[model samples]
Structure formats: structure tokens, C-alpha cells
Target: MRRSFRVLLCLAATAVGLTTLSAPANAAAHNYVALGDSYSSGVGTGGTYSGGGCKRSTNAYPQLWANTHAPASFNFAACSGATTTDVLNSQLGSLTARTTLVTISIGGNDAGFVDVITTCTLGSDSTCVNRVEQGKTFARNTLPARLDNVYSAIRQRSPSARVVVLGYPRFYKVPGSCNVGLSDTKRSAINSGADVLAQVTAQRAAAAGFTFVDIRGAWTGHEICSGDWWLNSLTWPVEESYHPNKNGQARGYLPALNAVTG
Candidate 1:
């Protein structure tokens, strides 16, 4: 009877070891799909995958996360210039029942972000302020409903996946003393617009039962003109302006997403 008991104990210990060994394989098998706009696509991070028109960079947060985690499948479907409607039409196909993780940073385009920035950078201060206000109004009023639809679509497409909605960071550091061409007043206005965008995004994300990753605080002291700026200033390719640099992806956005996804 003693010998039989020892054999049984050995068998149980072996079984436990096998299970432990297999756990990593199971984790590595999860499907992760990234869906969003230019930020997620790594517009300013400066590298591109062939033939997506989305300008996806190898250093983008989603790619960075995937490289570290080694998910069984990784899909980058985020696009440059993608609005909420563009996502609904073009990006949703990437999600499926097998998807285990989804990360997105959108709604900037929907809020007329480019228009506001253009006005702020080139137009008069008063015009910049007025356009920024218009963008803010849209963010507060119309953006929520649009966000809900996209969130709902994601839920329907990937019922069991964990969805994380990442908010945009302010382009300027607070107390707005940046020398990035735009005046301090315009910088403040842009920062305020970022705040509104984050607020509305967080609300909608919660309402849809998704996690909202607020990047505002993480990006503090790392705006366009800061010594350790993670975002690009007005660059040669204009499109890269105001977008996160490679450091922002590797440091700023990557850690934020990891905290939630982990």
C-alpha cells in the first residue's frame, strides 16, 4: 500500500508539471488585433509595412507589445486618416470570435483634429481658439454616439475579447511655454481640446464596457517641445506632426497598454 501511494503521488506531480509547461503555449496562442487611426498605425514613428496604405510602423505600440508577448496571431488594421466611420467600414473585418485582445486609439479624426491643428498652426489666435472650440463641441456632443456604435460593433464581432480604447495625449505640456512655432495660447487651446477628447472617450469606453487607457498623465513633460518629447513637432511631412514618435510608442503607449492587458 505504501508503494502504491508513492506511485500515485509521482503521477500527480508529473501531471502538474505538464500543465505548467503548457500554460505559456496557451497564452502565446491568443489572437490580438489592433484597430485604430494614425496613432495606432505609428504615423510619426517612421517605418512602414508593405502595402497597407495605413503606414503601420514596426515600432508602434501594438507591434511592440506583440513582439514582447508573442501572441499566436497579430493583425494591425489601424489606418492613417481613419475616422470612426472609416473604422466601421474598413477595420472591423479584422475582429473575429477568436480574437483575444484588441487595442485602439481613434476619434481624433472624427473631432476634426487636423482641421483644428491646421487652423491653430497657420491661422490667427482667435481663429485657432474658435476652431478648437468647435472641435471641442463636437467631441462633447456628437462623438459619444459615434464611439458607441464602433464599440458595439467591436463587441458584436469579438464577443470574448478584451477591448482597450486608448485616448490621445495633449500635444503641449501644461503651462504651455513650448517654442514649437504655435503660440502659448494656441498650445493651451490644443491641450484643452485633447482634454475634451480624453474625457468623452473615457465616458464612451466605460459605457460600452471597455477599458479606457488615458495617456494624458503618462505624456506629461513629453509633449512636442519638451526636452524628452515623445511627440513630433511640425515636421517636413506635415502628417507626422503632432503624432507620437518612436519613443512614445516604445515608452509611453506600450507601458500604458501593458498595464491593462497584462
Candidate 2:
């Protein structure tokens, strides 16, 4: 009876070892390429950056996903302040026929988000409102064609890639509890512009047959005005301002990407 019991244990252990050894062989190895602007590059996350001045942080969603998923190859091609043209000219070179996945967030900069924020921060209520309207107009009228160009290029280069197009979050929470920042009017206008950008980007992405992830809903109660801010508020060094913080990348964007990727 003792010998039989020992043989059973050995057999079970051997089976478990074989299962462990085979798991890696069955795991799919994906070729992933990340592209976009500051949001995708992770400017406000405050970790080490690569790709020269691209500011691609270790905490960014792409890196974080790669760390966990162990894709066959990860090309972090995203750059700070990248416009749609920038992606078309510079970023798409990393993507190829073998690229299994691609993720990006763009169009905000093309719509002049940085200038809008700067004007809203320093100028009077009227200036802020007007600037926000102009941004909305640009997003609605001009951004679709630019987005079409980028999406078309992505589809052309990486024909089989599962492309995930992420949109910007609303920068502020209107009627928020915070008292020290700009008036509710400015905050509301900023959100309206963000909505326009999201709408236009979503339409274009869908037309291109890509998955569109609207981060605005995921980032609710965590904008610049919230007590627990996922986005920075009028930060110094200029680039970090209006960008997402670490939690925003890890908790917010990461999960949003994971939901679709998984």
C-alpha cells in the first residue's frame, strides 16, 4: 500500500510538470506597436522616458500591458506632442504586416488643446469661452479628415492588427467641488470641446473598423477638479499640464485597454 501511494504521488507530480512546461508553448506571442501623442506617451506619469523626447513612460498603458502580457515584440513608437501628421510621418514606420496589435490616442493636439488650455487658464472668461468654441469647431470640422488619414495608414500598413483608438478624457468636472480653479463656464466649455473631439474621433475610428475606447466615461469623478485627480491641473514644466497622472494611466487607461484586449 505504501509503495502504491508513493507511485501515485510521483505520477501526479509528473503530470503537473508536463502541464507547466506546455503552457508557454501554447501562449500566443503578439507583435504590438503603440502610437499617439502625450497621453499615449505618458507625459504626466513621471517615470523614465525613452524614444528621445517622446516621453514614453514605463508607466504608460502600452508598457504596462506588455509587461503583463509578454507580447513577442513591443514597439513603443508614441511621442509627446504628436499630431496626426506626426503619426503618419514618424510613428507608423514601426507598424508592419506582423503587428498583431496597435493602440493610440490622438487628435486633441491637432484641435489645439494645448493652446485652448493656455488661453482658458490665463485669459478672461470670454477669451476662454471663445477659445473653447474654436477648439470645438476645429475638432468637429477639421479633425475627421486628419483622423481618416491616420486610420487609413494604420489599416494599410498593419492589415491584420487589432487597432484600439482611445479618445481624450474630459479635463475637468463641471460643477465640481473644487473652488480655486476657473469658473464653471470655462470648465463646461472645455468638456464640450472634449465631447466634440470624442465624437468625431469615434466616428472616424468606426468607419475604419477599429475599436474606439471613450475614456471620458471611465474617468468620471477623476478629472482635474476632483479631489482625487487622475489628470494634472495647470502643472509646471508646461508639458505635464492637462496630462494624465500615474493613476490615470495604470488604473484608468490600462483597464480600459485591457477590457478590449482581453
Candidate 3:
């Protein structure tokens, strides 16, 4: 009958409308926020990111990923001197309901690992090794709890966000050439320090149901002392500077972007 035909047509129209409605939500563009330390801030990499005046650079990994992938909205709250608490308190505020991706690199400063490196360079003896080892142990024990809190705070702030915790790259190669005293053995210890810290960070992020992007292997050929190094080849106030040059950042961070966006 005509009445039956009308009801069938109405149902089909409603189904089509429902499909159309669901499509947009499913296809909704993503919002991204990046939070972390100097490496994440893109300090030496030297390009101006959005909110450039905040001191974050355009070539920073977050901006790179956003520009390469074209997210719907982007926030780069990564500051040069950020720590774990800094990320949870200051950077977490930048995240919102629309944020689909959140990335961070933290805990190196928390462990005061940089100071240990400086001290080791000042003198190479059992005393120096002991001090560095002590710092490493402390970082291994204490950093995870703080990172856990950071992840928890982030998830609470943006439940829909895919949080990615990035590990720091190995600054020195097998035999760092920064100083004459930096022997192969000493350099190994430094690499070990970075490896431990990175693994701990990744493990903590994984425990919180977030993704952890390890960039150590990705940056194998581009370490600090390597020719055309991505990281600075020497310490501050020293030779060629030890942070990532533009090439280093591109090599160091691109794999992370690929892993994350894929």
C-alpha cells in the first residue's frame, strides 16, 4: 500500500541521515599538543613554531608532525627548561577536548643528569664515575613516579588524546670526541645513562596506556660527536655546541612522527 511505501522511504532517509551524521564525527580533524624539555622545544634546531615567542621553534617535532600531517588544531607548550612537574602543571593546560595527540620528553632534567655529565667532564676518576652512577640510580628510582603522574594528569585533562612519551636520544657515540679525557669507557657510561632514562620513561608511559616513542635507535648515526651530528658535538661554551642542529632534529624526530601518525 502507499502507507507502507511511505514508511519504508522514511526509514531509508533516516538511515542515510544517520550515516551522514556519523561520517563527520568519525572524520573530524585532530588536535595536537606537544609538551617537553629543550629537545622538544627545538632550541638549536632553529625554526619558529606557532607561539614562537614562547621560545618553542617551528622545526620542533610537534610542529613538524602537525605541518607534515596537518592537524586541525595544534598547541606547542614545550619549553626549554621544562621538567616532569612542569609538563603536568604548565603544559597540560594547553590540551583540550579536541586534542587527539599529546607528545612529551621529560625526566632528564629531573634526574639532574646534565649536571652529572658536566661533573664527569670536569674530572675523570672513580669519584666522577661514582657520582654519575649515583645520579643515574636516583633518576631510575625517582623519575618513573613523576612521569606516571604526568601521564595521569594528561589523560585526565584530555581523555581522547593519544599521549606519546618520547625518549631522549644518545648524545655521544661509542667514543665521544668532546674532550681528550672522554675515553671510550666514560662515553659508554654516558650512553648507558641516556638509555636507562629513556627506557624508564617509555615503560612508565606504557603502563599508563599511552604510546612511547623511542628515538635512540633512530638517531644512531646522528649522535653529538658524529660528523654532521644532529645533537651538539660539544658542551655549551665549548666547541661546536652539543644540541641538535637543524639536520639532527630532522633525523632525530621524523621517525617519531612516522610511528606516531601511522
- Model 2 per-residue lDDT tens digits across residues 100-181: 8999999988999889988988898899999989988888888899999999999999999999999889988778877546
- Which residue pairs in candidate 2 collide? none
Candidate 3, residues 56-142, lDDT tens digits: the string is 777777777777777778777898767888787678889887788888888888887667677767777565677668767977888
Off by over 4 Å in 3: 1-28, 47-54, 176-181, 235-241
TM-scores of the candidates in the order shown: 0.91, 0.88, 0.83
Counted clashes in each candidate structure: 0, 0, 8
Better of 2 and 3 by TM-score: 2
* Model 3, global lDDT: 0.75
The regions of model 1 sitting more than 4 angstroms off are 1-27, 176-178
Better model by lDDT: candidate 2 vs candidate 3: 2
Residue 129 Cα positional deviation in candidate 1, in Å, after optimal superposition = 0.9
Candidate closer to the true structure by lDDT (higher is better), 1 or 3: 1
Model 2 has an lDDT value of: 0.90
Error of 1 at 120 (Å): 0.4
Of candidates 2 and 1, the better by TM-score: 1
| lDDT tens readout by residue for model 1, 83-167 | 9999999999999999999999989999998899889988989999999999999999999999999999999999999899999
